[model samples]
Target: MSTGRDITALVRPPRSYFVNAPMGNNFGAAGDVATQSRILRAVLALAVEARDPGLILDDVLQWPAPFAFNPAPATPEAIAKQLRK
Candidate 1:
């Protein structure tokens, strides 16, 4: 079974999922670091405010590291280069 299916199978009883679209998509036309950060913070706040016991599949939370790049790139190629060693 696929990892996604495995995960889906593990979710029992009450289940909740949280997902953040790619930072670029979340930011929209003029998406920037500030905008992306704001959206991420909002999602975190919601998860914290939620009182019920449920899973939150927050993709942003799984980010390898924090967003610290200055003058963020505008394309996938640029972003990939930035992530390289």
Candidate 2:
């Protein structure tokens, strides 16, 4: 499965599943079992049925919740504090 289409395309695997999700949350959102299951099943089914060598399947799924970037802490100590929590 790939979250970065550019990188995946360069590597060129036999068959790949591409998800338009965050780098880490590639299978859907956190705690969303239904979406995760669907993505897994689709990939597995494609693996079995795909005939082409450089086939790339784009997932129609989107993140359940809107995404926003959180501002980073100004200081290293503040970043460490958040991580230690």
Candidate 3:
């Protein structure tokens, strides 16, 4: 078993680095090398710093700048339409 899609919530990983960005480009925004490295380092550091298991730490940086992302479903019908499609 455990061959299907790996759900995020279900899989209790020992260490997790949650980013504010989308699933596509979570490390950084576009070509932001600095931002990417920062995130990576933080995650790597967690491996050593983290003593407890199954800990999910949120990204320290709160992404301020707006980047092109999938807009949230505004209406109930819109949400249903997306689910249907």
Question: RMSD per prediction, one decimal?
Answer: 12.0, 5.1, 7.9
Greater TM-score among 1 and 2 belongs to 2
User: Could you tally the backbone clashes for each prediction?
Assistant: 0, 0, 0
lDDT of 3 by residue, 7-80 (tens): 43378677677776655667867889999898889888988999877677778665677555466758998878
Q: Candidate 1 lDDT, tens digit per residue, 1-85?
A: 0113235446732434333332445432243577557656766666577666554443343343444326654798877888994
* TM-score against truth, every candidate: 0.30, 0.73, 0.62
Q: Which candidate is the best by lDDT?
A: 2
Cα distance off (Å), candidate 1, residue 23: 10
Off by over 4 Å in 1: 1-17, 20-31, 55-85
Q: Is candidate 2 or candidate 3 better by lDDT?
A: 2
Expressed as tens digits, the lDDT of each residue in 1-85 for candidate 2 is 9988888999999999999887788898889999999999999999999999988899998766666556665798887888999
Once superposed on the true structure, which residue ranges of model 2 sit more than 4 Å away at CA? 64-85
2 or 3, greater by TM-score: 2
